[model samples]
Target: MRKYSRKKKEIAVEDYVSGIKSGDRTMLARAITLVESHTNRHFTVAQQVIEQLGSVKTNSIRIGITGVPGAGKSTFIDSFGTYLCELGYRVAVLAVDPSSEVSKGSILGDKTRMERLSNNPRAFIRPSPSSGTLGGVNRKTRETIFLCEAAGFDIILIETVGVGQGEFVVRSMVDFFLLLVLTGAGDELQTMKKGIMELPDLVVVNKADGDNVSKAKQAMREYNTILHFLRPYTEGWTTKAVTASALEETGLIEIYKEIEQFIHMTRNNGIFEKRRTEQLKEWFDSSLKDKLYAQFFYDEKMKESLLQYEKLIIDGEKTVGNSVNELISLFLNKKE
Candidate 1:
């Protein structure tokens, strides 16, 4: 009998870059998954692919949509993206779904609900599993944005997991942040809080059709009152409230106009490029911190030292602060 050995297939960086630049959706999807991977080789390949796509000039509209559960996020994206596609725009929707505890995967599966956009040749939708990442988004999402832009998509909509504090993370990466709110859903208190209200460039009262129309209008009024008290979330823009019915595809035009107005205002005032520059700087620092921490903590010798320090803390032999300092010193001094 012969023993069999299998080698992993090598990724060609130029091929991915060329394909993405040529607007090949398959290669774009592959590049996104490659960057999302945690392997060392894939990391190298991801870097190469991004580098080869340096300074892509596509001025795609990057927007982040966040809301509490049941705020009609998927339907909103489907309607908004379909509208954009009808206008001859190539749109990409990146929906971040909450992870399942058992499998650690996206539980809702955004595709099932985005049938209209999925069938549109002008649209591409990718659902990413948050996997309980601290920010409720994948760390590689910034990289994914670049890939989508390089693929010549004119519009990019990022739908966050909408589970606590994740809105802030998504806000940092997009030109406009839209907060979707439900009517008569006790969201007045949700919108009353200063932190959540400060994130949106626009606050939308979703499901504003039919019998809920009055409640949605009332919710819009309430949100407007709240916004009047809070300072503007972004420079050169005021957060406005509007009503929309994603299921009926009504009020989407207003949302689109708001986005266009934001982009125009920011671009004319030079804030658009400035914001993107700041986002890139923040991403670089965050990635550097992650890499350094991984290198220091994952070393075999350092891992053993960390376990020993953890035991000391568990046994109350050393304070957490003191143990952290000692562990840093151990790595700095290259001691096991």
Candidate 2:
């Protein structure tokens, strides 16, 4: 019997760029993997690929979807994404799954739940692990979105891991933010994160079919009343609540229309361009901090010093504030 080597072939940076630009899904997926990787080699290659691609500025929309657990988010995305594909838009769903703290393992099972959209030719669904970054959102999600857009995805849907601070983080990146909710508004509102109510541009009361129709409508009304009192996240836009049934595929068109109207209004008011500029600046600042953090923590000397400092602190030989100052000075001196 002949033994076969199982090593995977490494793609060239040029190939990655060309493949992504030409809308090759395989290359796009691989490029996203490169960006998501923690290794130094992968980071260099990923940055080269991204820089080569440049700022695409494609005619695209980034929509952030977040909701409470059991709010039927996957179901809604499946229905809504398929609907968008039918309207001749290539949809890309980036579903961020929460990772286990101990094992750092993620289920990444959004594809399984979004059966229809997963199978659709015009739709692409990528499930990413939060990997303990950005509050249950994939750290490389912004880069992933750029790659997807270069691959001709006109509609990008970022589905965050439930409702939490992750929604706030995702809101900063997307053009529109949508909140999905179920009946029992009063109880849910009480349990939600403190500033979450002020984040969404639109709130949908889902599962509005058969027995739940009346309850969903009541919930919608309650949400609308609450929303009426709060300021809208976007200027000159009214954030309202509507009822929808993912199972029945009802009210999806209305949701789409609302989004369409929003994009139009924002563009006319110049708020769209302004927001994108601010987002790009924020991304730069965030990337710089991440790079500095990696450099300091991953440095051999720094790691050794950290261990010594940690031990000293645990032994009550060094104060935390003093240790931190010393570490920073040491790191800067090493760089010098």
Candidate 3:
């Protein structure tokens, strides 16, 4: 006879707090899982954990890294993060993986890609599924950042799922935004989104090694020329382009120094503090919207009405705008 193992006991809120405070990796991972849960029971526990640990503040900086496909984002992070670790900084990488549409499962292969950093004691890499969220980011990413900060990681790196409108979303939540590009800027820029070029705090022409060094430098020069004409995303700062080779692990220090300078300038000028407050407000507003949407859609009466309205709209019996208005009115009336 095959016997199934019994369910493990649920961890208490205090245990989660204590484990995270003491830097227990397992506990930190579990806490993040709880935060990512969509179930009501888990949501209640997660909220309680976040509320109790709200005072766990640290001098942490969240840097978002995004690039076009095949831009070596994971490779670059592996090198850059290892460098930060060597410099005595505890680094946390939140790698957002795209979910499979059919199965809704993520490969979560960041640890495999960033082998060196994954094995480093000072580095913590958490791979989360985007779960079809707008911007290809995990819905609970901001909350995950809070948990990482509470776990005493001073350097938080967010690797977005490719580059697109996700750049704007990541930029809003992060203190710094980095864009990576390959050689041949002339060709790449044509295909790149105009809005994306304006978002990066720094642009790096990666893969600058071997026979590609000259091309990489030329690309960097071209990027710098383009950046010169565009307004920098951060006020009181000039965004520039540099070259780096993740494979050879060269030019990492330059990137680190550039980020350090940006952080210093932002902090001194009060932009850093102001941005953090804005991020909190945005998180609150977004969460409120999410809860309201869930409440309306999950209501049994609303569900029945929604199905009827959907059928009518699909069959062209009712106008979409009118159906939407009726649905909103119904939801509001139900609340009353």
* lDDT digits (tens) for residues 1-336 of candidate 1: 222354845547888889999999999998887776655556667878988899888778899998877788888888988999998999998865433433465623658789899999999988775454333134477888889999999888988756644577778889999998887535445544447878899999999988999989998888888788888988768888999999888888998898888899999998999998987887677667655765775578888988998999999999999998988887888744
Best by lDDT: 2
Highest-TM-score candidate: 2
Give the RMSD in angstroms, all C-alphas superposed, for model 3: 4.2
Candidate 2 residue lDDT tens string, 22-99? 899999999988887776667778878989999897889999998887899999999999999999999999865443
User: Which ranking of candidates, highest lDDT first?
Assistant: 2, 3, 1
Instruction: Assess each prediction's global lDDT (C-alpha) against the native.
Output: 0.80, 0.85, 0.84
Steric clash pairs (candidate 1): none
The weakest ten consecutive residues by lDDT in model 3 span 130-139
Assess candidate 3 and give its lDDT: 0.84
TM-score for all models, in order of appearance = 0.83, 0.88, 0.86
- How far does residue 90 in candidate 3 sit from its true spot (Å)? 0.9
Q: Write the per-residue lDDT of candidate 3 for residues 4-103, one digit (tens) a residue.
A: 4548567888888889989999999999987777665666678778888877668999999988778898899999999999999999998554433334
**Residue 170 of model 2: what lDDT?**
82
